[model samples]
Target: MTTSIRGTANADVLTRFRRSAHWKPLEYAFWCLPVLAYFAFPGNYLLLSQIAITGLFALSLDLIFGYAGVISLGHAAFFGVGAYTVGLMGSHGWSDPLLGLLLAALFAGIVGFLSSFLLLRGSDLSRLMVTLGVALMFFELANKLTRITGGVDGLPGITIGPILGVFDFDMFGRTGYIYSVVVLFVLFWLARRLVRSPFGQSLRGIRMNALRMPALGVPVNRRLVKIYTIGAAYAGAAGALLAQTNQFVSLDVLSFQRSADLLLILILGGAGHLYGGLIGAVVFVVLHDQLSDLNPQYWQFWLGLILVLLVLFARGGILGTAQQWIESRRQRTQARQRAGSTS
Candidate 1:
């Protein structure tokens, strides 16, 4: 009886997972917007590329905070590690973009894996402090290592060769934009698959109730560490993309502000959902661009006001609030149809 029950439960989980993973028409339309942007905004590829990179970074944070219920104030540590990885590699005549990105992800993953153990030891506050401390340490280390990192002056001479030896990164950012979009798509696809699987369901459970997960045979700490490490890799890849596309590296990559901005992006887009980060990135970047052009000094003030309004009125950021509204409308429509049929 126990074996049969367990088998049935597993089958049910698989069924739900598969159903969620099935792509919806809206998702297809969402992806088409990026391709459309290529023609719609021919001269804005540079900004678009930055948006893509920021989106990926937000996605990484979502993996940890949104999915795993982890709080990090220093996630930029991995980003810096990845940026420096690409910078160091390029400065040393290994300008292969792909290899640099790969190394960045690997090194960042290692750092994340090591630090995740510490994260498992603390409460949310402690975890936040630990993450912040780690980032500060990296920031100070980079500042001290002026010879390798160029410190406050920034890492120079980062020459990224043509991607795949064919697409040269042009000043117009045509190639860089495409490359970033491709990487974002591939990673997003993998993440979608991951979060729709049984593993992802367990994560949601753990997030809601960690102690209960352990009772259910889930190794809570191990799972957290794995997701944290993967999130680090994703951040590293984002950093690598920034470094490669911009052909420069700077201490700013490791700044607390970077992580804070990332958190803001996630909040604005709504966490826990995959599309939230991407959508948030687009809105944030465009807002920044337009606002800065309109009022460079007071843009932040306006941005804060907008955020406050959203938090008060939108409930679950943009996407989350939209989903809620859509769900409510659908329920109302269904009720109306059912009532009409009965009458």
Candidate 2:
């Protein structure tokens, strides 16, 4: 199976991931550093938490789009389903955090599984239409089911339960941030493990050639279904996290813009790279925050321009470029040393 990276040396990046013992400590620090920073700065809790939630959502897309080569426009369907599930559950006074999370995953997974037939078609344009159609149907349903969904007015007054029956969500947003970060990291770790496993290789193989995989006795369709369901669960879990933090559910949360925004993030981060989704999410959210503060109208325009530049010029996004430059420099230095030693 062909890996995401192109060219000989680029392949080494994925294959030799653990060869550099130096990266081990840094990789550990990468996960730990954020949590540490979150703890250190009380005021930044809300920001960090929200960022993690968005990052998780984007990560879902990365799993499918980046790893599985599947393009989905209806991602918001699962996200919305997860959010509305939480809202519905809260209305019934079912607010245990774990229950909500589990329900979110179940609901999203089912939705994803059901939607896999559409996703399996896998034509870029057809997949877009199918995915977008699903999201639109969900959005309209939310409006039509006013009695249950609260309709356009939104299902307000949701009361999320305390964390593990311990930390009560407060006005200062402490619990929300911590809950989001912890859950986000746990799942993020799971995602990392997933793509590293044999399943991940199967996905890459399927992405490269669906016809060959089935002929070779691999269940191509089944893998697609499994990964789609997993991705949907990730999206749904993200929605649940968002609902728990905000204590409010709105139809807007499941809109096309959310899905579109997530796509932009993954593209910007250079999907297929495990860290790409989060990196893109951070850049996007930070840009949104800063730009919105300056002027809402201009933010979209400027960010859009930046995105065009990225898609056109940056193949691997920021990290990809850095990796390329480092590899190039290393190659040059090695060549120079070899020449001098021979001289």
The most accurate candidate by TM-score is 1
Summarize candidate 1's per-residue lDDT along 1-343 as a digit string, tens digits.
Answer: 9999999998987787788989999999999998999999999999999999999999999999999899899999999999999999999999999999999999999999999999999899999999999999999999999999999999999999998899899999999999999999999999999888878888899899998999999999999999999999999999999999999999999999999988988989999998898888999999989999999989999988987898799869899999999999999999999999999
TM-score of each model, paired residue for residue? 0.97, 0.90
Candidate 2 residue lDDT tens string, 20-49: 323367577778867786768788777877
Off by over 4 Å in 2: 1-23, 39-41
List clashing residue pairs in candidate 2. Answer: none
Regions of model 1 farther than 4 Å from truth: 1-9, 341-343
TM-score of 2: 0.90
* Candidate 1 collision pairs: none
